[model samples]
Target: MEILMTVIMGEIANRSISFLIDKCSSAPKNQDERLHDLQRLLLRVNVIVEEAEGRDITNKAMLYQLNMLRKEMYRGYFIMDNFRSQANNEEKNSEDGNVSHHFTPSKLNPAKRLFFSTSDNAHGKRELQQSLYNLNNVIVDVSEFKAFLRNYPPLYRQPYSMHLFLDKSMFGRQMEMERILNFLMLPEPSAPPITKRVAVLPIVGVANTGKSTLVAHVCNNERVRNHFGKIVFITENDLKDRGLINLKDRDVVLQPNSPLNGNGQVLAIIEFSEDIDEAAWRSCLACATCLGSVVKIIITSRSEKITRFGTTEALVLNLLPLEAYWYFFKVLTFGSADPKDQPRLESVALDICKSISGSFLNAHIFSSVLRADLSTTHWCMVQATLRGIMTRNACLSYECCVNRKNPVYVRGRVTNDLFAIYPSTEISSDETVPETTLPELLLGGVRCEGKFEVLALKSRIAPYKNYTNTCEMLTPRSTKAKRHQKPR
Candidate 1:
């Protein structure tokens, strides 16, 4: 019993010393100040114990009273530090004259302080006085001592566990993913019978084409979410174990057996790689086909070849139209929509769209890079840079098409002076032709293929509506053909 009392007294002394150190660190500095404060606190504890001795306390009762006194001293020191720190910070703020008037004290910290102070005051005096009145009553039974400790309110320290709370953006993504699952499982008229129509969809496009964002948008759309039973999305460049492939397969096979059933209408959207090896492609395809007719698989990739593998049809995602690009740009620049900046923002957006030529990825990235600082000079620079890039790309595309050896042609009607023919390729008209006579060229290489005949040419005439040049070249000359003609 004496040993237990001694341990309790030691704990109280340690807590008192720690409280004094914290207070001194924050207070106006004085040499050896914390040591002096701790000595003074200990002297007060000794005085309380001496006062209890005069009331006829036995050895055991005196020890219990001393432990109680030490606990009270520690509690008082902690309260003093709390008050001193607040006073010190307020003084510093007032002296500097920089503290904001908008600031308000926290309700939680002050409430905790009041609760601790009330309990310490009630227990320390009553327990000490009762122990002195009767030696027998001074020594507490072990069970009652435990009960006292339990009944006392706990000290409120600054919490470290509050970090578990999530931010808004993370929650939004989770909600979006949930909504997409609903859309992918929706019933469709074009859907194949529950067993045969199960197919994989690979959405392939170049870099920055908004593949992830498009998937997010489709999943979030109310119409799509309501129609589908289960929509599962597999993000790109993840390993097999991370639900890149295996998790997707389980969703299709184990969940629902029929498209009409709640689980069977699983829309598995996968991401394919630009340079995926044959083994990986085969594995991905096998996983996709596991759902039979009920599964609709969609993959987004930069490689066109990846889309063609084990798939019936593919839809190419084009660049965003001008208006959509404008909306995206506005959102990126200002957190909220600003009507005053609309004209300047639109001009900048249009220039970027033309340069990227409908590439949603390019527009998104470029907009992000320029979102900050909406200055006139910055907008002008962005426009000039995009125009330069567009001009360069056009020149390169034209040159590449023109240099190819194969003759390219587009089917179009001929009329008027020039035979207008649409070229099948991007080559320039001037590069292919040695002569201006377009009609004589058309008749030279007319060849038959099965039922249809084709005319191959080195070059085609401009202004495709005109055919007068073609007619003159096809006309027979009066002197040359008659002598060679046989008597009919």
Candidate 2:
């Protein structure tokens, strides 16, 4: 816990520093000095925290002290984050008008007071001094905790778990993999030849539906290897400050003077996150179009909203079928061995399979938890825990297409046999959504009347129009552990 908390503190500090440097660099002249000073203090604090982190501290008292310091650092980080976000927004607004020269007499916002001067709080030098002092006290005496300063390497977040794909563990995505390959490798004659030359293929689905895993699979396919002369993989971290064009042309490591081949084709696979700037996408598209080559792009995202950004929808991955899901679950738990080989666990394993719905990610997670103990007692405990989570949700189940938002009721049937259910609401086309909505279970165990403000943006594209929509209910935490989990 101490190590993970320290790592998180480091990440927060790093992000805060990067945010200030990138966003506050163009602040008003009066605010430049304050921003620079703040950045300097943060840099000092970051160095201390990093140095302390490099040393392996085993002493319990020392560990507790470090944790206390980490808490203080977290508070500082929150304040810094608030300031940077405000400044970023203000900077955008400032671009529409001329940059202000004089400091305003109006009472400054809490964040602005840190930099902007007013009659009441002149220069904010005292507050800045106090902040630096607190950071200094928290980070003081690092060498006392360790015999030597170990040169620890900087941390980098893995794009996705390699364990999922290792030892031929990936399952039930061959059809989706082929769909991406068809879009990239197979030519579209109906569309304009030029537009087809540089087309955007979007892989849209809910979170943890293996969107990244699917893209990685397609990128590693044998056919993809022969088609494109050049391929570039873009990660979320790669677009920290630069746009996509820079990432493709400048950031990516490419061979010198490697010109396009006969087809003049370049395949770029981007793992798109929700926080991605629209300008970055446009910049990348413009660069690809100007390259005079057939730039086939594959982008993976959770929201169907990205379709509004002039992208052609290629694949919408839904949950796997029961048989395929069971195969996936079996592999994750029992490896290559047959689950029936173990007579003791056969019945318990079948119950687990039935309870998990069709989420491959959840299956992998729950199976791992079950693998910890093969005894019937542990299996029953796990089963009861999962059932408790499902039964607590008060909702109504309806049959609906996975790609559509509106739920369709089955005539003369109180109970329907669908793998997934969606919340009752109308799908909207508005792309500018302010919040995200997670779905809840609608039937069985407990019942309560209610309505939810759900955000279900349905896809209108063909083939997908008939896709079976599954509700994003509570998956086992072990499935999404990486998301909520901090790196140690």
Backbone atom clashes (below 3 Å) for every candidate: 27, 4
Please provide, for model 2 over 27-60, each residue's C-alpha lDDT reduced to its tens digit, 9 standing for 90 to 100: 5444445555555666665555545544544344
Q: List where candidate 1 sits over 4 angstroms from the true fold.
A: 1-197, 221-230, 235-245, 248-262, 275-282, 288-293, 307-312, 321-353, 365-371, 378-488
Listed per candidate, the RMSD to the true structure in angstroms reads 30.4, 26.4
Residue 220, model 1: Cα distance from true site in angstroms: 3.6
**Where does model 2 exceed 4 Å of error?**
1-167, 187-196, 235-240, 243-245, 248-263, 275-280, 290-292, 308-313, 341-344, 388-488
Q: Report residue 266 deviation for candidate 1 (angstroms).
A: 2.5
Error of 1 at 403 (Å): 21
Among these predictions, the greatest lDDT belongs to 2
TM-score of 1: 0.33
